[model samples]
Target: MNCRPRIRASLLASCLVLTVSSACGGGEAPHSAAVGGSPAAVVVAISDADRAAAKQTFETVCFTCHGVSGKGDGPGSAGLDPKPRDLSDKTWQASIGDEHLRNVITMGGAAVGKSPAMPPQPQLKGNPKQLEALIQHVRGLAR
Candidate 1:
């Protein structure tokens, strides 16, 4: 069985969804508008597919340095000067805000005066759904 084709196809589909969503302004916004002047603050649920994609992305991309459990002890972190952050740290998680997380994730750690080893994910700047899914996934690791 050739798993490469399946993996390629899944990646292609995910990329298509991301491209289409960005092109169609599928970023953050209310699912429906309210009857009043301002929009409602209804929480949008993350689909299982998106959640799975986020997990895959984290494993493939971030896991190189952050590890599968976000312990900052991945194989790639061995050579890094400053170790990657442990995502499950309750104190650290409580100290940061979502916006700060978003900024660091999108603009890299150095952008927020953190570690320069954390590369910026410019691709996620336009895809709020995936970005938010990744953020939520990180938040879920809090221990």
Candidate 2:
């Protein structure tokens, strides 16, 4: 089936969120954005460029196990113990700090007392901004 309508609808929704954000006297998401149905859900108010980069990184690296929307049900996750993290989990996402997220992504799960199955993303390390973007992208998945 064609998905253009759904895609357009999602795009429109996102645009509306931006417009609402601007009208509220700032370009930031309110608290509701953290859980869903808003812009300020994960990470923080980020630039478009950063959002794009983070998304690309997630799609390229994290999607294999985290799945497209981070539900932890990617094709590869089926055979793994503990499975990949469901990045879309709002509570799980909120409880974790940005630093913790960076550590897990940069050094891998084993370094942070998590499952060893999660690989280290050395390429994402050392770059603070890029790391933050990925964290934000993960946060956005909660929505």
Candidate 3:
């Protein structure tokens, strides 16, 4: 009942980023990688409820490698070889499809032909919604 406004603001910002990520032609993931252009842009203005869920998931699950801004400079990136991809970089980020991102997260980087440093999240196997949220969070980082 007494949360800090700054924390709330940060969560909102993260939500906005994820919404834009999903809207930016990333498709619904799972073999869908096309950036659909302007129509997708409109969806970037997603509801706060969606952002809250995406932001919370990212903070707890991905902040280690992707960091708060998804810049791949988290505390866990020190000894990595290829280094974590900067999720916030639009160009490099664009090269990766939403499904590819999902694969990398759920099945790890090796599953999607990426680094071994990026471990797979088998625990999320049965949770389709959470996996989707993670993908959206990755997409949001691009924004």
User: lDDT tens digits, residues 5-48, model 1?
Assistant: 22232444434455434421344332332324322221234578
Tens-digit lDDT string for candidate 3 (26-77): 4343222234331111122345565677688788767788788999888888
Writing each residue's lDDT as its tens digit, candidate 2 over 8-61 gives 323444444454454222443333323222222232234688778889988877
Local distance difference test scores for all models: 0.71, 0.68, 0.62
User: Among these predicted structures, which one has the highest TM-score?
Assistant: 1
What candidate 1 gets wrong by more than 4 Å, as runs, is 1-45
Judged by whole-model lDDT over C-alpha atoms, candidate 3 comes out at: 0.62
Worst 10 residues of 2 by lDDT: 1-10
Could you give the candidate ranking by lDDT, starting with the highest?
1, 2, 3
Over 4 Å off in model 3, which ranges? 1-51
List TM-scores for all candidates, in order.
0.69, 0.65, 0.61
